[model samples]
Target: MLQMPDFLTLGHVTRDLHSDGSFSLGGTVTFAALTAYHLGLAAAIVSRADQQLIPELSRYLPNIELQIQPSPQSTTFANQYREGFRTQYLHARAESLEISDVPVQWREAPIVLLGPLAQELSPDIVSLFPRRPGTILAATPQGWLRRWDADGRVWPTPWMEAERILPQIDVLILSHDDLLPFADGNRRDADAILHRWSMHVPLLVATDGRHGATLFRHGQTQRFPAYPIDEVDPTGAGDVFAAAFLTHLHKHGDPEQAIDFANCTASFSVEQPGIAGIPTTEKVLQRMNEKKNLTT
Candidate 1:
């Protein structure tokens, strides 16, 4: 194996099958890793990208540290929807990461983001680093609950392992709908359920469509309004937002700046399709600068 890069991303890789003529590549791992690279971070990705997709995945992927694993079968996803509503289905097995696969050089790194696509990604992955240094950002429960039927329709399953995973996450991000599985689809009851979910995670965020999102940290609630935009295809917007948010937090160490940057980045993402919507860090900065100028 080549020397593993010090910066790493643990997440999923899925073939995003859409209704349009476009069969694009997607996943938290792809968007986040790429966003980090755009922001000048040394980045690496560990995911299941079989022989076939690896060639394609390599092209869009910059020359950086990459770890590819063979799967029983490559993981595939069909994201089907009409208008703004959407549903997904899984068609194949995604790979899993053993503790042994984590690079020794990364043992001391201060930042790691845990992102997953399907059920194959386990909370047990966190156990791989008991003494590992720094923060661990987890896009969980949302990732943990994903399951696909034999016919490729994605649905929710019990994330029995979430208890183990929650305690391991420093920052957790999920959509308001992602809480449905745990809340039994009860929107009104999600608040109580989320409170329990946040006990283990120091910072927790839940985004609710155009209604905006909630941030819970240090026993206080802060809400940020979602920038209104005509969403074209919101495929990877959340992942991109999380990537931008994390980049800001890591680079500037300020909560408000991170949220503002993240909101702008995410709003920018929804204005286009797939990964094409992910803007560069400079674009994000420029947009923020514009917003600040108008407000002032």
Candidate 2:
């Protein structure tokens, strides 16, 4: 068995298609894991990967190990834009990954980030992460709110098992729009919303598009303004943010620094298209130092 890396992110693996006909490999775990690897962390991706795609993905990223569940085919997705909104369609059913697929050695990883896409990261997956010392859990709730119709149409569906999963999360990241439907419009202020959510978990974060993000922890809250950028595509920016945030925590253990690092990292992601736009840590730091907000 391969030794467990320091950080492991679990989620779906998909090929993304933008409206411009640009196609690239995507999904939160894919981009997030890569960001962690680039930011000086030992990173691995536990995904639902098929035999066919695994061989190819391995070739592109040989250094990054994949703890993939055996599937008949990889999960395939195509997204298009209507105005600034996005519409998604699922092209294939990926093999659902189970706790049994997790390697014994992987439990040694100090941090585990759950990057759910589709319905891949279910209650079963939440229960699988070892609840022990030195291991932290982070989750993005987008995966829980997604649903597909018989016609293959995809959209946000209101179903959050967060209350059940809260104890497992050391940090929970999500956008205001992602959970608004499930939040029942009862949340008036963003901070208030976070407070309500954190009643179950100590650390909760609610992200707002272009307005930056807010973090609530132990009765304290920290807010960061989203860096201004001409958005070429906002596709994987959230995942990029999560990846950088978690990487900083793994290395520095300071929430403030982690949020700033993540803000800079995500600022760099939206200036390009899909995964092709993901900038290196040096590139992000350079732009941050230069303070040049280049819009693509």
Candidate 3:
């Protein structure tokens, strides 16, 4: 019998090229799956990538089960950061994922994260799983909100399927940057849009890098501050946050504590490059305690 995973993520695994001519495994599913694994869950990934990336994924995520749809090439990205702002380029894209790509047994996963990258996953992919009590379906919709020009320069595009997708999920996680294109960089406008979307989903979270995150629930909003840390690389921090929040929420059923744990997890992620910075549960709890001590 195939063992059902505790946490499952669907999307594309990316090959991220760095300025120093180095490359590493990336993508929202990559980070989120690793985060769940490190947090002591039996995590699995459903992604589309080239066969070459299979070995790399195995090395990084030793215990996690990977259901990969073979593609000629993996999704590829190059990021240029100038003065704390990042401009991204998409060089190659892998094959798109369909409902058929997901395993039958995995469909019953209690926790599912739709972590699309390069728009490889369609909005209808949400229907692949059964929605029942105690099941948490969360999405990090960054990929759906992105578009690239002829030169493959990536830019934000509105989430055109929000009306169709929002009501189907339990939690929605997105970054402030993801909202900027929709709100035209207007804070109030972004909050308005968030408020509107929050009504459809049970929980809505918007992460602002370093500054912290805001949570929307029961038609009310609460802000959670990011844990302070000297940064090394911010790549995959939002994905890390979403995974941590969902994992904690699934186990403890407390959004407030989940966000605090997520904030601490994300803080640790930025202190190192790639998934090396993702913290263990003990480390996150230690950081949480230290923060409480300072405040007390």
Q: Give the Cα lDDT of each candidate.
A: 0.71, 0.77, 0.91
Q: Per-residue lDDT of 197-241 in model 3, one digit per residue for the tens? A: 998899999999988999998569999999888999899999999
TM-score of each: 0.89, 0.88, 0.97
Q: What CA RMSD would you report for each candidate? A: 2.5, 3.4, 1.2
Task: List runs of model 2 lying over 4 Å from the truth.
Answer: 18-22, 183-193, 218-220, 290-296
Question: In candidate 3, which residue ranges exceed 4 Å CA deviation?
Answer: none
What does candidate 2's lDDT look like per residue over 91-164, in tens digits?
Answer: 77687778877788886678888887788866877766756756678888787788899866787785557678
What total of clashing residue pairs does each candidate reach? Answer: 3, 2, 0
Could you give the candidate ranking by lDDT, starting with the highest? 3, 2, 1
**lDDT (10s digit) by residue, model 1, range 16-96:** 766774567788888777777776677788877678777777787866567777666567777666796677777676677
Indicate which candidate wins on lDDT: 3
lDDT of 2 at 241: 89
lDDT of 3 at 84: 72
Candidate that scores best on TM-score: 3
Worst 10 residues of 2 by lDDT: 182-191
